[model samples]
Target: MQQQRSLQAFISRPLLVPALLFVLAVGLRLVYVFVTSTQNFLEGDAGRYFTMVEQLLTDQIYGYGSEKSNARVTPGFPLFAYSIYSIFPFTPNVFRWVHILIGAATVFPVYSYVSSVSRPLLGWLAGLFVAVYPPFIYMTNLFLTETLFIFLLTLFFASWQWMMNKPSVWSVILNAAVLSWAILTRPGMLPILMIAVLFLLFTRPARRLLIPYLLTVGVCFLPWTLRNWIILDEFTLLASDSGNALLSGAYPFFQENPDYKEMYSLGMSQTQYGVRVILKGFKEHFLQYLSWFSFGKLYYMFKSMWVSSTLNFPQLYMYGGVLLHYLTLLLSLISVPYLLIKKNFLAFAFTGMLLFQLLFIPTARYGAPFILLMVLLICSAAYTFWINRSRKPNYKLPAGSAS
Candidate 1:
């Protein structure tokens, strides 16, 4: 009896479950890395990132191919790669090991946010879901911004929630700093800062700290902006990739029509050309464009794990991931009404972020970082269901009274 009580106490300890989840997350990512280590883990944008890092080290430039400096991509991931290569030998696998640690660490914010608002069991489940989620595990073995960006993004959400609850100056500053880091990692995150600002403006207790938050974020971004001004000879804010992204997104299913390609080749600036193409497409095919930008993008973004085709995985793992993703999606759908009825500000912020992503081309890679939010929503719904079920009156038929 004493042993049973002790075991229950140990299990119920506040930190034990999250710690276990963290260990589980790390173990799974490590296993993935080891299993896929022999495979070609570097593909797609990994090459460009490596090239940028090489330029950063050798020539102190930030662009590809050594001729000139351009802000094709944000400096965050390149800088991160630079730091890693500076200390360790420049190898993709070396970065994979680091990413494994980072990918696993993301579990903390998910656990913290969910557990703070709901039961600890829900928090543990959310953390476990992320820990075992295939895309999160798979991305760690590849050289991409997803692992680091997702970590900062989740941390930002947790910090934002903390500020909303307590409304402290320090929390606001922390939130801003995390968000600034996220923006550096992915320029698409800029709109989230705007959403956060609007959130603060409407939130009474946090209204006063808005200036500090903005100032902190501005201060964080100032150096990068200045770098663009001095080095690239333009007053770019985050990155110069947006124009190309817009062009890519302008096409239905990202399948560019030949006429659109010809128009782009005709010498307009990328931004102007992309805007023209998008406006022209909308004018010509309003319904088609609308459907592509809305449900089509959402479907592609959340459809599958964005793992590299080069990496080898057991077939069972892939199938399990698909099943888990659909399960989370279904649960999130159920939670949406709950979030709306509760007026959950975080839900609003997340929705704004998703809507903003629709302005660009979205894929599973883009959606991978936000999976934890889905898991959080799932947990919230599960907790609500559990609580409602627990509270129901349990009246049994009196002895033989039931007809």
Candidate 2:
């Protein structure tokens, strides 16, 4: 009986659910990794990242080659790869395994963020959703920035929630630090930081720590900006790829026009040329540009899971995954008004992020990081529904008098 009670106690521990979710997450990802072990990792953007890591190792440079260091891409992922390659042999399987671990560990923050705001059971559900999400598992197989960026992004949300709840100096600093790393991982995330700063300025409990938060962010960003300014002779805050991103999005359906290429061939800076193309496109095709910016980009962003070409899966699974993606998005959108009515700050920040992505090229890969957030919102809505239903008084006809 004592042994039985001890087992029950262990089972009832607060962390047991998240721990089991983490194990399940790791197991699922491991199965996928081993099955796809023979697949090539150096595909698409992975090749560019691999090349950057190679340059960092042998040439001690961060750019494409030894010619000159450029800020086209941020150093976070390459540095992450470099740290791994420094210890282990540069092999695809090793990197994938490490990424699998990093990807699986994201479950904790998802659980923490959800559990803090709602019940623990909903938190477990959110973590499970992340554990089995198809695109998140597939992302670990590629040597791209998505895995690391997603992990950091979730951690940022978790830390932000923690600071809001407790309002400690250390938590404030930690939130700022996570935000800095997130921006460095994906320069597009810079706007989210601005949104956060604006939110904090208005929030009472967190307003006092805003200066420390900004100072910490500035401290974290200083070295990278200084490096870009010194080596590339440009004051690139995060990266120099925004121009290409703008140009890519300037066209409807991302199809480049001949005039865009002609303008680029005239030796104009990419940023300037991209701006000109956008202005011209807006002037020439106002309605088309408006639709593309508002709804078209949103449709493409959440349409499908970004699967690896080499990893073959059943068509049923792909269809089901896409169906689930749409369902989650729909449910999350339905929950937004509820969240706003309750004055949820995180909801505003997340909505701001979704809106901010409209300014760039639309790709499902960009939406992968927010899968956890969508799951959290869905679980929150579900939990609220369950609670409301349970609280309702049961009504029945007395003595079956009704017909």
Candidate 3:
């Protein structure tokens, strides 16, 4: 009896819960990694990133080839992977394990964010959801930006949530640094950060801290921009992938296959070609595309669960991810009323990012980061419902209301 009581006491420590969650998260990621590591194969952007890392290590350049430099993809992930490979031997397996740790570490931010505003139960739920989240787990084994981008995004928002209330210069600088790294990892985050700037300006405490935040994010781009100009002779800010991404979205063939031709080949720059293709496609199929494929794109962003062709798991693996994603979306919708009541416009930053992808080229992989925020909102709503239920007065009905 004494041992049982002591065990309970040990388990009930304030730090034990998150620590256990972190351990469980890491364990689950390792299980998935072990199961799928044999099937690890790089293709498309994954292949590009792999080559970029090699180039980074050998030539000290951030591109694909020995002689020429390409800025199509941002250097953040490659740079990060290169830094890792620098310390360790060059092995993709080791890199994947590092990513597994990264994906697992995201639980910390999720727990921190949820605990800041809601009950510990909700925090545990958020952490657990992220721990076993199928998409997050799967992305770790593949060499892609999604895993790192998701981790940075969760950390950024976790800090942003607290900074909104505290408004410390240090916090602003930290989040701005995270935001810059996020953009470097996935350039799509640039516009999302812009939306954040606007959202912060409206908040009382955050408004006073906007200048340093904006300046930090702005300055973070200069070094990359300079690199782009010196190497590619292009005044690129985030990356050269933006125009290609837009082109891919506008190209109808891109739906079925990634190898699509540029419809507009008038020697336009990447930016010009992207704009021309999108405008041209919209001019031809404005209503039909907008009414049908646009919604389809949005649905794909939220619903599809494309892990990898090499996944040897059962069909349930894919379907399970879709089911959880759909359920979370529903919960997020249900939570909207609560968010509105609380006047938490931080949601705008996430929604704007989602809508931006929906408008252009959204994939299941791209939606991974958004799921972190969705998990928080869903757990928050669940906790709110639980609290209200517990608080409901146990009023006795008059004599015979409904015996």
lDDT of 3 by residue, 295-320 (tens): 66767667655465525445676566
User: Residue 370 in model 3: shift from native, Å?
Assistant: 2.3
Which of 2 and 3 is ahead in lDDT? Answer: 2
Query: How many steric overlaps are in each model, in order?
Result: 0, 0, 0
Ranking by TM-score: 1, 2, 3
Between the candidate structures 1 and 2, which one is better when assessed by TM-score? 1
Worst 10-residue lDDT window for candidate 2 reads: 308-317
TM-scores vs. true structure, each candidate: 0.90, 0.89, 0.86
TM-score (C-alpha) between model 2 and the true structure: 0.89
**Candidate 1 stretches greater than 4 Å from native:** 37-39, 64-66, 255-261, 264-266, 309-311, 384-403
lDDT of 1: 0.80
Estimate the overall C-alpha local distance difference test score of candidate 3.
0.74
* Candidate 3: 10-residue stretch with minimal lDDT: 256-265
